[model samples]
Target: MSEGVTLDRTGGLITLGAADTLWADLMADSAVPTASAALTSFPAHARMGYVLLGDRVVATVKTGSSQWSVLEIEVRQAAAELNAVEMDRQDLVRIGPFRSAAKQEPMEGTALRWRQRITRALQERGGLERAAREDARPYHLAGIDWRRILVEQTRDRTVRTWWLPRAAVRVLDAAEHTETQWLHAARACQASAVVTEPSSHHQQVPALGSRPTTSPDCPTAPLRPYNGELQGHLYSVLSRKPGTSRRVAGWACAVCRTTPATVLDHCHEHGYVRAPVCQSCNTQERPDHLYSNDIRVADHYRRLFDTHAADWLRHWHRCPGCRARTTLPLPHLAAWTAHIACRSLRPTHRDARSSRARKPCGVLRVSWTGSHSAPRSCLLTVAVDFCPSGEHRVLAQVPYREAAEQFRSWLAETAPAVAAAAGPDRLDDLPTRPRPVIADTSSDGLALF
Candidate 1:
C-alpha cells in the first residue's frame, strides 16, 4: 500500500474496465484515501470524460484544481484513442443544424425594435430632404398666376393630409376587397333580399288596370331566404388539416385555447397575449365593466400602499403608533402582516354565522400625521382586536403598520385554530423591549431603534 493511500470497503485501487473505465479508475483512486485526506491532498475537484465503444471502455480523468492534472489526463486519453467518432449520424445532424440555425435567426424583441427604429429614421431624413428641395416658384409667379398657384398648393396639402402610409394603404385595400367579396358571397347565398313596405302601400295600390307585376315601386315582404353557402365554406376552411395556414390563423383565442370564436380578446393593457385568450377575458376587460373597475382599483391601491409604506418605514425611526422598534420596512412588514392577517380571517361557505365568526379576527389601521420631524418618525400603531368573543384586544407600536396589519390578517385567516388559541389579550401582556438602533455617523444619535 502507498504511504498516503487509505483503503476503503472496495479494496485498494480496484479499477473496472467497463464502459466508464476512466470514472471507475478515478473513483477507485479517490476512495483509497479517507474523505478528509483525499480532500486535503488529491482532492475531489476532478472531472472525467468517457466514451464507450460497445463493450470497450475509454476515459480521461482530470483534477479541476490543478493544471498539471488536466494535461496528464489529456495526454493519457489521447494515447488511448478515446476521442473516436461514435455519435449517431442523425443526432449529430439534428443538433449541429439546430445550433447553426439558432445563430442565424434574429432575436425576437430587440431585433424587431432595431429594424423599426432604423426604418423610421431613414424615412424621416428622406422625407425632410425631399420636402426642402420642392420648388415654390408658384408663390413668386405673376399676380395673375398667384391665385391659381395658391389653390394648387392648398390642394396638394389637402391631398398629403389624406395620404396613407404605404404599408397602411396596402393593408386597407386588401381588407376592403376581402370585405366586399365576403358580402357578395353572403348575398349570393341568400334566396332573396328582405325589403320593408311603405306605410301608404295599401292606399297607393297601382291603378286597377295595371298588370300585377314585380316592380321597383312595389315593396317585398320581410323574411327572405338566404341564397349563399358562405357559412358552410367558412366551416370547411376552419376544419382543414391541423397545420394549415387557415387553421393556424383562426386560432386567435389565447385564454380558452379555442379557434373560430365569437370575438378576439386583445388585452390592451398587457399589450400581447403570451398565450391564447377567449372572449371572456375581453368582456371582463371592457372599459365600462365592473370587473375591470374592481381590478384597476385593487391594483392601484396595492401599488399606492406598497410605495408609501416602503418610504415611510425606511425614513421613520420609530413605529408610528406604539413607538416600538419592531417595526420593519414595508416589504418585511407586508410579508409579516399578510401572514398574520390571513390566519385570522377565514371565510367559509357553511353559513352566515360561521362566516361572520371567521370575518377578520383582527383590524389594523395606519394614519400619517403631517409633521416635519427630523429623519421623520412616522407613528405606526398596531391594534389586534377580535369580534366573536369580543374579549381580546392587543395594541403594539410597530414601524410599518400596513405590513403588520397584512401579516396579522393573513395569519388570522390561514390559521384560525392557532390564532384563537393564542388569544388576542396575550399580545399586550408580553414583555416589551427596545429595538437596537442602527448607528449613523451623520446624526447626533442612532436613526433607528
Candidate 2:
C-alpha cells in the first residue's frame, strides 16, 4: 500500500472506495487486529474504469467527525459544506467542442454568452484561466481535434472554466489503439469472474465508430461509419468478409443489448469502430465523448471497449445492467452523473416522496387500429390513462396504476368471454374485422400443418 492510503479518523478525510461504505468504517470495532494489515489501511480504492455520467471533479466533504456521511448527520452541516463546493454543479454550463466529424467552429453567439456571464458574475473576486493537464497526450491529427476542445466552467466562487481535454488520465500509449490493447483487460475481467472455461463478457462495451486513421481489422474495417447508410452498410459488412477479417457477427445495439444494431457507434475520442448500436442508443447517446468520472470507471470503459466490443454478441448480452438500462435508458453522461450523485441523498428523497401516489386519474379505452402483420402485442393494455400515447410509450414506461385494479379485475373476469368471442370481430369498427378465421389444423401451436 502507498503512504497516501492511510485513513486518519481524527483528520476527517473519509475517502470511500466504490465498494467501501462510510457506515462500515464508522461501525468497525475499535483496535481489533486482522491477518491482512494492508486492508485496514487501503480498502480496495480502485474500481473498473467506466463511462461516467460527466466530467466531474470530486467535491470532498470534510468534517471533524468521520461519520459525517451517515444518514443521521445534520443536514444543515452537510448542506453547508457541500454547497460551498457542489451547489453550483447544476448551473455549471459547458462550452466548446462545438465541432464534430462535420463542423469545426468555436463557441459563438448563444454559446458565447455563457462565459461572459460567468466572468461578469465573478467580477473582481476571481478570474478564469485555461488550465491544461500535464499528462494529456493528444493523438496526432491533420488539424486540431475540434471535438476534443471541451471547456466546463466550474461553479465555485472563483468560477474557473477549464478546457481540460484528457487531463490527468493515465491513458494507453499514444501509438496503441484501445481495441488492440483490450485483450489483456478482457482476460483480467474473465479471470476475476472465475470462469473455468473462456467465455466472452461485454455488458457495457462502448459502441464507438471508426476513423480513417484508426486500425482496420476484420472487426473494424467492415463496420460502416455513423453517417453512412445503415441497413445497406450492415449488409455489406456481413456479406463482404475476407479471409483475414471475420464477419462482424452481432447485430444488436451495444447500449440497449436487445435492439438490432442499427448504427455503427464510434469512439468519439479515438474514432475507432467501437460497436454496433440501435437507433435508440445512437439517438440518445448525444455526447461524442466517452465519459469517465473516475480513473477506475474510465479504465473499465477502455478495457471493455477494447475487448468485448470487438465481439458484438458478447458485448450486448453478457452484462444485465446494459440490457436493463436500455428501457430505463440511463442514456448519457449528464443523467448518469446526476443519478450517482443523487444516490447519497436518497434517504432525504425517499422522505420527500412519502406523499400520496400519482395513480391513474382516469382510464380510457382508446382503440388502436393496426395491420394483422404488426410486430407488437404490448399495445392492447387494459390499464391506461389519457396520455394521447401509442404502443411504444406504454411499453416503455406507463405502468399499471393503483386505480386500475378495479378495471383490471373486471377485465380479468371478462377474459373467458373475450377468448370465446375472439373468433370473429363482426365488423363493428374495422372494415377487415369480419375476416375469416384460419383453422389451426396442426396439433402443435406452430400451425405448420
Candidate 3:
C-alpha cells in the first residue's frame, strides 16, 4: 500500500502512476483525481489502414486512386529483383524497379522490401481471407480492441490534454469509419517469405453494391422496377437450375475483365446500357467518374450512345421526356429522327422540341439548340490545378473514334467535349518541373482510359 510515485505536483496539482492511482485510497489522500494527467507512453500505431483483426484484415485506400492494378500478387525469393506471381492482375510480370509516373524513372526496389515487412507484420498480428463474403462494410473496426490514448494534461486547471494516438479505431452505431473503409486488403503470406521491395495492388474483393449501405452520397434510392431485358435476364438467372448450365455469374466485367459481373454500370446521362463490366465496375467505376480520355473509353461510350440510346425509354424508371431517373414512367421513347413529335400513348404535357432534340444529355433545358446529329461529349482533365507539362483532355462524341489513335486527334479538334479520356502527354517532359496528380505521362502516349 505504500508503493507511490508522484507524477506531478503543483499548488493543488498531483498525478499518480497506474499503481499509485490504484492504491491511492490506502494512502492518506484518496480524494485527489488519480487519472494520469501528464501522460508519457504510447501504443503502436499502424501507419496504413490495412491492419489485422483476428484472422481478417481491414483496409481502405483513396477511392479511384487505383486506375489499374493487380488483383493479387505474391513474391517468390526475396532477391534484389524478384518476379511477382501476378502482374497487372492479368499477366505475371517480374518486378522491375517501379517507375515514378512523373519522372518516368525507375525507382528503388526497397518498395518491395517494405511490402514484405508489412506482410509479415500482418501475419504476426493476425491474417487475411480471400474468398468473398456478402456482409462487408466500407469500413470496419473488427472488435473492441484493448487500447487507449494516454493524455497529457496542461498545468492550468482548464484541463488541456494532449492525446497520444497509437492506432486507428472507431465507435459502433456511429458515422465513424476506421480509416478502414473495408478490411479485406491482405493476402495469405508465407511464414518464410521476405520482401526485397515494397508493393501493393487491389485484389479482387466484394464490390460496393448498387445501393451501398454507406457512401458519401446519402439518401440512397430504393430498389425500383427495371427494364424488360434486365428483368428478363434476372428472371433467367433466378430460374436457372442450381449447380447447372451457364449463369449470369459467368458474365465478365468489360472494364477489368473480372469474371461474373455483379452489376451493370450505366451512364446516367444517356441511360444507354454499356456492357457487362465485372460487378466491381459498379462500385469502382462510379458515374460522374471522369475518364482521362482515351480512344478505347471514347469508343466505349460512343458505341453505347449509338447502340442503346433509346434503351432508357424501355425502362420503367425514366422521365421519358427528359430521360432522368424518376418514378414517373414516360410512355414513349424520345423520337430520334427530327421533325416528329414524341409519340406517347399517354399525355406527358411536353412539346415537340423535347421530342426531337438529338443526343439529349438527360438534363432538361429551357430550349434545345445544337447540332442535332452529334452525340453529347465532354472533356476530362485530371491532376492538380497547376500543370507545367501540357494538360490534355478530349470532348467525347461518337465521331472521334478516328481522332488520333489516342484522342490527340480530337484533343486538338475541340477543348470541350463530354467527360471521357485519361492521362496527359509529355510534350515538355520536364521531369524536374512541378506537376501534381500525374499517374504516368510519356511523349509516346498515355496508358489511362
Candidate topping TM-score: 3
My TM-score estimates for the predictions, one after another, are: 0.17, 0.19, 0.20
Q: Residue-wise lDDT of candidate 2 within 1-449, one digit each (tens)?
A: 32333445533233333112332232233121111211112111112221110111111232444322111121122223222321211221133222221232343321112223233323333322222222232211111121133344554554444332221110111111222223334455556665577654422222222121121221222223322223212223433446312222224345555343434543221122445554434433332222121111122232223333334323332222222221111112222222222223222212235574333222222122223222121122222234344321221111212212322333234333322322223223322211221221111111000
lDDT (tens digit, per residue) of candidate 3 on 1-449: 23443322211112223322322233222111111211111111122322222112222222234321111110001110111111122111111111322344332421112222322323343322221133132211222121122233333564222221211111111111211122111221323337886654533222322212222222222222222333212223333446321222334444444233434433332233444433223322231112212111212222223443223212222212122211111111111110011112112233456665433212110111222222222121112111223222111222212221333332223322211222233122322311121211121111111
In the range 232-312, model 1's lDDT, one tens digit per residue, is 122233334465432222343333232222232221211111222222322222221112111111122232234333322
The CA lDDT of each predicted structure is 0.26, 0.26, 0.24
Rank list by TM-score? 3, 2, 1
Error of 1 at 387 (Å): 42
| Candidate 2, residue 281: how far the Cα is off, in Å | 4.1
Deviation of model 1 at 324, angstroms: 14
Off by over 4 Å in 1: 1-13, 16-41, 45-331, 334-399, 421-424, 427-429, 437-449
The residue-level lDDT of candidate 3 at 233 comes to 27
C-alpha-based local distance difference test score of model 2:
0.26
Deviation from native of the Cα of residue 4 in model 3, angstroms: 51
